[model samples]
Target: MGSPSSLKLGVQICGVGYGWGEWRHPDVPADASISLNFYRQQAQLAEAGRLDFLFIADSLHIHEKSNPHYLNRFEPLTLLSALATVTEHIGLVATASVSYTEPFNLARQLASLDHLSGGRAGWNVVTSWLSGTADNFGKAEHPPHRVRYYMAREHLSVVKGLWDSWEDDAFVRDKPSGEFFLPSKLHRLDHNGEFFRVKGPLNIARSPQGQPVIFQGGTSVEGREFAAGHADVVFLNPESLTEAQWRYQDIKGRAACLGRNLQQVQVLANIRPVVGRTASEVEQRYQHICQFITLEDALVTLGRPFNDHDFSRYPLDEPFPDVGDLGREHLQGHSEHIKQVARDEKLTLRQTAWRFALPQREFTGTPEQLADRLEHWFQQGAADGFVINPWPGGLQHFVELVIPELQRRGLFRREYSGHTLRDHLQLSTPINRYAPRRELI
Candidate 1:
């Protein structure tokens, strides 16, 4: 919303990388996923690039066949908190699920992060999609897709209400008067809802930003509605520009219909760009990254969206097996998207497996070419910005190559102009709901 000429970018700081084969790349360390130093370095690198934020993705459940990076990775909030001290200005965004966490705990932890990071904190709200996650959380069954949304709405409502427990000037330490805080400035949430019943004030005071930014990344019908009604930012994973454009328009329209400010909401697409100086180098890098993924690994990876449906049992060359409603209960949108892709392309089971496993080539090209694609997306209103999910060594390439091109074209900022995440995004601080209209302390 600051300017149509520039873009906001965030780096996905996953150590082993987004692709299943990425850790096998020579530039990546096998244990980088768990290494604090590795994360520190990535955070510093992203900050140096003047990126908008650092996104740390998390999942509550993992099986033996899970992606190597997911199998061994730091928790999002813990990792981001560690990152906060080493880097300044770069927003720290952590993904946490509403289905498995208590509202008070989640609210307190995220508020703490906002305070620790000097207001550069964001929470990417997620409804846990894996059916197996229920086992970890001690639930008899995972909440249905619709039920998860209902719980998410209530959970988020309670969290926000708690976040507003104290006014900005609530704490006033006066020695002579022996006053620690203004009593009238402190308020209680006293929330009782369908999913959460939290009472009284939050333990922490209002953070520098007043409230930490809210991020929503669900793509289903319910997910989009949640984002439109509540999210400050929306994360998307569209397979093509056409899909991205449709989602972009749909989300903006939905928010508009709800009478929300269009500029207050931002849409970010997740792009894994395979970059190089030359076409030959780009192809080589792409192939090099692909070599590590075996057919078995692809099958296992494919099974994930289908609620761990065993794709191995079906013939590789045969048409994708019809497992109706297989993924509807879990990852409904994603599983459906995969099935649609398979149907549209008439791909074999093996083809569908590899298609999703390997990084999409829509963003594969030289620096200039990648810049062209990104600029197109921005100018055409397909996205407000992008969450750059790098392959092994890809972040460095993007930072060094594509970013420079964007800056030169006046499509990105060459330097930081502000400190807080809201400032970086040119968004105004939200007034506390509990604060009086014209009262000043």
Candidate 2:
């Protein structure tokens, strides 16, 4: 808040990249989806550009009609662990679900990553909204929206409690006195909640940043409230500057209402950049990517929010099917967005499918022009930063071209100011919950 110069940037290292047809692109490696080196290279590029974090989004289940990248990819935490060794400063953020994992184990795993990476770790907390995910986890039905948020709130509380199990100075390792750890410093989290009852201290000690940064990405009413109360960052996918501004104000206002400092919670919108040396080139590249998307693939992407309800059975020229209560319980926000788009544009089923196929162009111009748009968003208070998902062959261009333009404009940092992810993002190190109680006045 002190200056207008501060800006946070992150690149989503989406497996095989973001576009649905990216894997088939000539410039993209055919095996990029499973290649560790591909991710390693991407991480290095982001670091070279002085980006804050490399985000890896995940899901527990995949349909046969899923995108090539989703059909095959590394698990988030495991992959981030491997990435930690190769990279030094870039924050490694992985999408993990409270719905699918227990609090204690996840807390330990994230703490370990923070230690291994020297505190450059972030956890994108999700409720796991994909349809059929519950089936794989031995549950016949997915929890309702409100119930999922309830579990998430309780789940985060338990994890945070477990993280504070051991005080920062608990480990003595004093060989001369034959002392290893102070006994009184360890605290057990006997958390009893409606969803879970985790009783224990986390096995791992607190890491350098105290705890990994918490990120949440849901726009529903419950989601907004939960994020305001708990998350350090809120990820968004707003469709326009007006929407982004509205959402930005809403989130910060909610946080303030809950007695949280407005600066503590950052809002990062998803931005898919399509940079080019010329406007004509950008159009060509956009069209080229669009050509690779098959109607079948488009249908699969369009149907995702509706719980993979197959759109193939209906005639392509006809209006979208009524989808009566198809995704009412799951992906309600996204399904509603899609329905609104279809209704507003009066798009046919095929047109809606095609629209879904094309990547949303958050920025598409020369590097300088792209920089202008980003600056506009930042200065206008539409966003604190952006989580960029570059299309195939776009990463190198963005790093080499757009990044420098931004640096020239003094919109991004030329060098990392600190080691931890929190430092890079300008977020404060959280206070340890187990600290000694102060005497009352």
Candidate 3:
């Protein structure tokens, strides 16, 4: 039997933010976006489900046209602080751009969330390649990729140093001497780098989970290298078992080339599941969900797969441009996969594009079948786990249906094994740098 300790699973949820048709779903509470209580309830349900962690994605700035659809959501760090009070074992993973946030402040926020959640916190570091966001932040354009990655390397170093500012035993709240904290245990990080100058001893003490889990997902070559060096969890996109296996091997191979332990990191693919008790019922519900898509929205959504392009800006009825200089070489990494899928499904360009609009790992079946699909992927090394994208009211369906099936099969935990997201996920707590190394301190 495979060691259960080797089994890793996690779930990343969309905050009341841009889940394509989520807010419109009838099952979703009408005031879900306006109410913190709505999020609070979701947090409690995830806890009952024994999930490893719940991830909250963020962006530094709003998109111009898409803001109406997505921007009405709470900021992740603040919302998570509120959630920390309610959930017991799920990690609170929030995305904060390295391009925008100060390392000291960012580290402090993550550590504070970790402490509040009793050591279940994570940071999904993003480089924020969007020019619109950079423009909002007082820059003319987005920083070039190489420059951004360099800044990120330094930013991560400084953040980690700040996290290590205090030893776990640094806080000595002893009343006898009236010292609230031990001065000796603190180390100031005088970090000066090519992009940033951060002088810090974080105001907060060591975080409960050592440092909150570092979860990152970017599939570009630069992204892969960064994740291998620093991320605890790496997210990816895989459309099939073959794609998942190939991606897993590629990442593992890259990690080995960089001399990092592949096992130290995890890879989770995103998935949007629409399940039902019967096959026809599943298709029927999927069709109903499809009705929410207008002919125009469907046509517009196709052109911007992965935010690479905004086809919506163009009239759907218009013909696309054929550039003289951009004949064939400009095709992206997934172009062939898209082509093959289009061919296999006999789909038109518009249909193919919208069908695969969201970066989804498809699993359409009953609850038992979904669990089986997950186990198959887990065993085949396609992924270490999945990050579920629930469409609003359907989230309870996950806890009410899918989780129990996984639990019964012993594919997932019946109860949290320990407090904290890292513990539940079985990820190791990071050790402080300059701590006593004796056999017994």
lDDT of 2 by residue, 262-281 (tens): 77799998888788899998
**Candidate 1 deviant stretches above 4 angstroms:** 1-4, 437-441
Q: 189-272, model 3: which lDDT tens digit per residue? A: 898778889888889888767888888776656777888888888888677899889888878777788887676778887777
lDDT by residue for model 1 (1-441), tens:
335457989988887876566687889999999999999988998988889999999898888777889988999999889999998899999999999999999999999999999999999999988888999978999899999999999999899888988889889999899999998878888888788889969989999988888999888899899999999999999888889999999999999999999888999999999999999999999898889888898898888878888899999999888989898878778888999999999999999998988868899999999999999998888999999998888889999999999989888988888889998887779888868653654
Which is the leading candidate under lDDT?
1
TM-score winner: 1
My TM-score estimates for the predictions, one after another, are 0.97, 0.96, 0.88
Query: What is the total number of backbone clashes in candidate 1?
Result: 0
In candidate 1, what residue range of length 10 has the lowest lDDT sum? 432-441
lDDT of each: 0.89, 0.86, 0.71
Tell me which of candidates 1 and 2 scores higher on lDDT. Answer: 1
Q: Arrange candidates, best lDDT first.
A: 1, 2, 3
